[model samples]
Target: MFELRHVSKRHGAIIALDAIDLSIAAGQTTALIGPSGAGKSSILRMLIGLEWPDAGEVRFDGVPLRRETLLEQRRRIGYVIQEGGLFPHLTGASNAALLARTLGWETSRIEARLRELAELCQLPFAALSRYPAELSGGQRQRVGLIRALMLDPAVLLLDEPLGALDPIVRHDLQTQMRELFALLNKTVVLVTHDVAEAVWLGDTLVLLRAGKILQKGGIDELLDVPADPFVHQFMNAQRRLREDA
Candidate 1:
């Protein structure tokens, strides 16, 4: 569904991504996993056209991603960031329906879609009336998910959507997220620092370091055949974190 070929990006003196080539399959979930400065989030930013690469190209559904085509391409992509990225003043329902409303969708249609998403994401009907400030962390993330899925986009790009929640909430949402991905069957690219989350949620995992891809494959493949010592250290760091926990 998406492809990045020899992509690179830089911010002043800092290189965010370098010579990164990756592909995301249609109707499958892929995870970009790494520590800080690994360029995981940069990949999402490029995919959403928030930032452009200094070299190479980004393609969506076989078309080049350019400014002229970005608006139309974004319509088919759903994106969610940490803490929901919700507007502070808007009610959850209103936030979810903002795009649809802007697109001139009828109120009846918007309401119907909200109802469907509320059920699909297991969000409380009562909570939809609350603003972002009025909801718990978990609730806010669910509202974000609802907003992203509101348009029934063909691709889902989530950057640390569960990163801020408490453990219980993160665990609950992880299970729901897995189910949602399978149920929707949309191409999904998730950026996360959590190894277990990446392994559990992604059909394919791309491990990155220093703005470059270290390895990309299934969980077992990564564990069994690390590309370099950095890969081993990165994977073991997660294990140590769990052990410490």
Candidate 2:
């Protein structure tokens, strides 16, 4: 549903992304993985129209990304970033209903949707009245996810959404996230440095490095036929690492 064609972005002499081309299909999850400075976040930024490419184009459903249609297109996609990014003062329900309020949804409709989302995300009804400061890291992340999914966007972009949680909470959220995505059938593009996370959440994986794509394919394809030694090593290490005790 989204396509990036030969896109490149630069900051003076530094290249943030280099000739990157990617496509995210409907009702599928694609993960972007690599070391830091690999242009993973840059790709998300471009997709969300937060950053424009210096060359080439980013298109959503065949339409070139434009300022006029950006808000409409964005409303059709959900995004969650690292650290939850919730307003410190807004209650969880308020946060989740932000978009709905903007769209002129009635107070009752917003309340009902908030309740439904809380249930879907396995959060307590009481959480609706709590602020970010009152919740644990995991709770905050779940609230963030619910906020993004409130409008039931066709596409979801998650940029290291689980990074700030504790290990156990992270693992639990990972499973919950997978189940939620499958149930919703949303087109998902997730950015994570963790190779295991990429494999677990993505039907297809793209390994990036130095602002360029190193390889992209299904999990089995990449594991069985790595593009180079770097990919081979990455896959092997991920396979061998044991869960933290």
Q: Whose lDDT is greatest here?
A: 1
Candidate 2, residue 160: lDDT: 94
* Model 1 lDDT per residue over 1-245, tens place: 99999999999999999988898899999999988998999999999999999999999999999998899999999999999999998999999999999999999998889989999999988899999999999999999999999889999999999999999999999999999999999999999988888877889999988899999988777777889898878887676433322
Superposed model 2: Cα runs more than 4 Å off = 241-245
Where is model 2 poorest over a 10-residue stretch in terms of lDDT? 236-245
Candidate 1 clash pair list? none
Model 2 scores a C-alpha lDDT of 0.87
Q: Write the residue-wise lDDT of candidate 2 on 1-245 in tens digits.
A: 88999999898888889998888887899999988988999999888899999999999988999989999999988899876789998998888888899899999988888888888899997987999999989889888989899898999999999988889999998899989989999899999987787777888889888899989997777777889888888767775322320
- Per model, state how many residue pairs clash: 0, 0
List clashing residue pairs in candidate 2: none
What is the Cα-based lDDT of residue 185 in candidate 2?
91
lDDT of each: 0.91, 0.87
lDDT of 1: 0.91
